[model samples]
Target: MLDQQAVDAEEERLRELATALPDLQRQQYFQQLKRELRDPDTYAALNWCFLAGLHHFYLGQWQRGLFNLLVFMAGLALLFSPWPWWGLLFIVLISVAELWALFRSQIIIQHWNNQIMRRLLQEYSSAE
Candidate 1:
């Protein structure tokens, strides 16, 4: 159907993004991470490997990273408080969201790389 075609197109785009130069720049973003230590794919996987917000932070998405972190902290607080059942439910929700983020990491990284590439390309072209 139409959705299948869209998926295929997105896959093609991701393949193109993988070889793009902005992927290198994305890797060099965080000084603490070390330029050679983290690539786009690895950064994306870190979302699940470390925390649900880690990837977003790597990508310079402050709002998303903060939101996820805050939600997790609140959930942990609730877990030890009187609302144990609510905390469990929140934890379950976070787990599901994390799983989704883990599975979609490749696509997410590709999308972010594409954006970076576009901006870099535009800047390079404008300078010329």
Candidate 2:
């Protein structure tokens, strides 16, 4: 568990980091976020890839994506095999992999969205 002092210190550090960015870069960041949020189709497409474990490609994490894809394929193959035990194991593994990918993707997307929102809020506060 995190102590209150530690949490407060982290918040202060985050505020400092936000203040460090120049206005133009911060505006660009906010614009990018607004564009992403306004385009539902685009956002859906990107998020779909994340759910499929293919978003890593966009982030240049190809190796991890390939590994996950291969694992999923192997699980599918095993699931179709004649041996019941092997099939069950493969199904279980595949389910676990899918869940893990889903959770990771959600976290990544949430983090990105939060950053965008933070930038927008900061911009608005500064303007005011």
Candidate 3:
């Protein structure tokens, strides 16, 4: 079995890899997207798919992330309930809200990762 320290170190490394992006390539993609979409705010937020706990998986928090994803999926499944249509409608409404939260969380995580990558890259390039 791996020791706690070793596990911690591995987790840290994985988190770094998860958040690290190719600066030049990412910048080029961002620029292209910006040019195509005149509204900056529209693309500023993180993608809903990423926010749905995919970032957590990237950071090595698989269990927590997976749990959240399952919850979201459950909520979606609830929309198909056979009870009165009202129950289904209510579940659908709740699912929408959950989706919104997932989207917001993803955007926050992406911004955070971008900031960290930017700093790391700046330091690495400057040192060379």
Best-fitting candidate, scored by lDDT: 1
Count the clashes in each prediction: 0, 0, 0
- The local distance difference test score of model 1 is 0.61
* Per-model CA lDDT versus the true structure: 0.61, 0.55, 0.49
Candidate 2 wrong stretches, greater than 4 Å: 1-16, 29-52, 82-84, 101-105, 112-128
Error of 2 at 48 (Å): 8.3
Error of 3 at 51 (Å): 4.2
> Would you list the clashing residue pairs of candidate 2?
none
Question: Which 10-residue window of candidate 1 scores lowest in summed lDDT?
Answer: 29-38
Segments in model 1 whose C-alpha atoms lie over 4 Å from true places: 1-40
Q: Which has the better lDDT: candidate 2, or candidate 3?
A: 2
Model 3, position 35: C-alpha lDDT score:
40
Q: Which model, 1 or 2, shows the larger TM-score?
A: 1
TM-score of 3: 0.32
User: Mind giving the per-residue lDDT tens digits that candidate 2 earns over 20-126?
Assistant: 66787556655665565333234345535544345555545689767756665666677677765775675566556656444445444544455555666576557
The sequence of per-residue lDDT tens digits that candidate 3 reaches over residues 1-128 is 22445544544664464345467644554454334322213322322444345545554567967776676566556656654455455545545654654545534444444445445445544544
